[model samples]
Target: MSLLERLNSDMKQAMKNKEKDKLTTIRMVKASLQNEAIKLGTKELSEETELTILSREVKQRKESLHEFDKAGRQDLVDKLRAELAIVELYLPKQLSEEELSEIVKETISEVGAKSKADMGKVMAAIMPKVKGKADGSLVNKFVQQHLS
Candidate 1:
């Protein structure tokens, strides 16, 4: 099934199982997806668009989790961690550092990137290949290390 369909099915299961936290997270994802669709004046969203939205949601949760961790709020951190886990269920399998490094090396060569000056070209070439599979900050780090 498509990601959206799977999400909808899970949402129904959450409701049936009285899983309040899971239900809330799924509803938030659905709302984000619907908002994006409305913004584009379309009822159907492509899988790529859905993945982008899900990644954004996961990023937000991770940021919040970091803040909560710094503040020593274990309760909030735990909740956000659980939410993050739920959001991640829809994302593609994340790339390991070695895998990401390999891709970055290939992209740099493909773009003929030399030195930090060519970071933009290399990044543009790599983003499409890595999107939804790796985090932007992680990719940026790899690009910077390889280019510099």
Candidate 2:
């Protein structure tokens, strides 16, 4: 089933179970997806597009979590943590550091990236391969380590 189908199924379950937080998150995600499809003038989104939107949602929550952590807002931080957890449930399984390292090494060799100067080239080549599976910052860290 597609992401939308999964979300709809889960949404109905959440409503029946009285899971307010989960139901809200599901609705928000569904709305964003529909909005994106409208914005792009499409009837539906491709899996790639869906993954891209989901990744953006995850990234946004992470950024917010970081900010709340620094501000020492425990209440907000806890809420964001919960929301982040729910959002992450839809993302692809994350890549381990070792696995990411291997890909970075392979990509570096393939692109013939000699040093930091080729950071852009390495990132452009690898991001598509990794996409939502790996965090961009983690990928950048690996690329920097391998290149330098």
Candidate 3:
């Protein structure tokens, strides 16, 4: 099933099971999807678009978790962790390091990125292919190391 359909089904299940945390997270996802659809002047969102939104939500939660860790707020950290787990349920599986490395190498070669100066070009070229599958910063770092 499409991500949105799956999400809708999960939302109903959450409601029926009285899973408060899951329900909240699913509601947030539905709202985010609806907002994006409205912004794009569309009645429905594509699976790729929905994945992008879900990835952004997961990324935001990860950043929040990091900040909570930095500030030594265990309670907030724990909450964010739980929310992150819920958010991650909707994201595609992450790429492994070896897979990412292979892509990075191929991207560098394709873009003819000989030095760090070409990092942006290589990244721009590779991002569309890597989007939602790998972490941006990790990809960038790998690209930089290879190019430099």
Candidate 4:
């Protein structure tokens, strides 16, 4: 089934099961997806676009978690962690670090990226291949390490 359908089903299930946290997170995701659709003047988004939106939500949650951790707000951090877990359930299985590293290495060579100056070129070529499978920051770190 499509991501939207799956989300709708899960939302209903969450409501029935009284899973407040999961329900809230799913609602937030649905709202985000709907907003993006409205902004683009479309009724629906493609699977790839949906994945991108989900990834963005996960990234935002992780950043917030980091800030909360730094502030020693355990309650907020725990909440964000739970939300992040729910959001991640919809994402594709993430690539292992070693797998991501290999892909970055291959892309660097494919693009003949030798110096830091070529980071952009290498990233542009590699991101499409990795997309939802790997975090962009992690891929970037690998690229930087390999290039330097």
Candidate 4 runs further than 4 Å off: none
Top-down TM-score ranking: 2, 4, 1, 3
**2 or 4, greater by lDDT:** 2
lDDT (10s digit) by residue, model 4, range 13-90: 999999999999999999999999999999989988998999999999999999999999999999999999999999
The superposed Cα distance between candidate 4 and the true structure at residue 41, in angstroms, equals 0.6
Please give the RMSD to the true structure for each candidate, in Å: 1.0, 0.7, 1.1, 0.8
* Model 3, global lDDT: 0.88
* TM value for model 3: 0.94
As for candidate 3, its clashing pairs are: none
The TM-score leader among the candidates is 2
- The model with the greater TM-score, 1 or 4, is 4
Model 2 bad stretches (over 4 Å): none
Candidate 1 per-residue lDDT, tens place, 1-148, comes to 8877888999999999999999999999989999999999998999889889999999999999999999999999999998999999889999999999999999999999889999999989999898899999999999999987
Which window of ten consecutive residues has the lowest lDDT sum in model 1? 1-10
Clashes of each: 0, 0, 0, 0
